[model samples]
Target: LRINDPGIDLGVAAALYSSRLEQPLDSDAVYIGEVGLGGEVRPVSFVESRLKEAEKMGFKQAYLPSPNLPDSAQKKKIALLLSPV
Candidate 1:
């Protein structure tokens, strides 16, 4: 499920991981942090848009880093995973 492409972005990686996780990313939610060398989840750009897209797609949850989360989104119907970087 590796998105190893020249135009690879966090969204691509997240989509791949979500598909592997069997979450049906078309209407599911997922996020990729910085992606450390050790495979740790780090903070990524545009947290708000990611969450918003998930919600718009009818996804009831999300996986994201705690550091990059928005205060307003913390209380949404979505689930947030405070992953370690």
Candidate 2:
């Protein structure tokens, strides 16, 4: 749980971690989003690039904000979990 990147957004990651403490997250899934104080997940910038990188790195899924989803994501073959902030 030690984060190395200060610039990395962790709102959604924190929520996921807290919610899934009893169960581990999927190893092949990448999570990306900002969390609001009210626990809503918000979109981040460069979502397409991030998803592409995750796909290239062999990730099978992603959890991101709905607003961050790219139109071309359907072609990437990665499962997406979208939430609203």
Candidate 3:
């Protein structure tokens, strides 16, 4: 099976967001990564810019691939879950 590289992240986010309506997802959290058809989370490029934008938007948490993570203090607040988010 093939995954639509560009749309995977948005598709995953939409699914996650819809599922969280009843449980309530963390409003300050952001998710940035590609969800493969095998359910694996893959890293994307331009991570710095993405994280910078998220931070600017007041997001206190982020779920991203390990390889895309930064060691900055701002990134310390991130939450990475390899499994379904």
What TM-score would every model get versus the actual structure?
0.52, 0.64, 0.65
TM-score, model 3 to reference:
0.65
In terms of lDDT, the poorest run of 10 residues in model 2 is 4-13
lDDT tens readout by residue for model 2, 1-85: 8874322555346556667886666677677876667766667777777777877888877777777666664645545444433
Residue pairs with clashing backbones, model 1? 34-42
- Tens digits of lDDT, candidate 3, 1-85: 7765542484466557679885666777677787677877777888767767777888776677777667666455543322224
lDDT of each: 0.57, 0.64, 0.64
lDDT of 1 by residue, 6-70 (tens): 22244567777778998866444454456666666567676666666667767655656668766
**Pairs of colliding residues, candidate 3:** none
1 or 3, greater by TM-score = 3
* Backbone clashes, each candidate: 1, 1, 0
Query: Candidate 2: where is the Cα deviation over 4 Å?
Result: 1-20, 72-85
Q: Which 10-residue window of candidate 1 scores lowest in summed lDDT?
A: 76-85
Which portions of model 3 miss their true places by more than 4 Å?
A: 1-21, 71-85
Model 2 residue 29 CA deviation (Å) reads 0.5
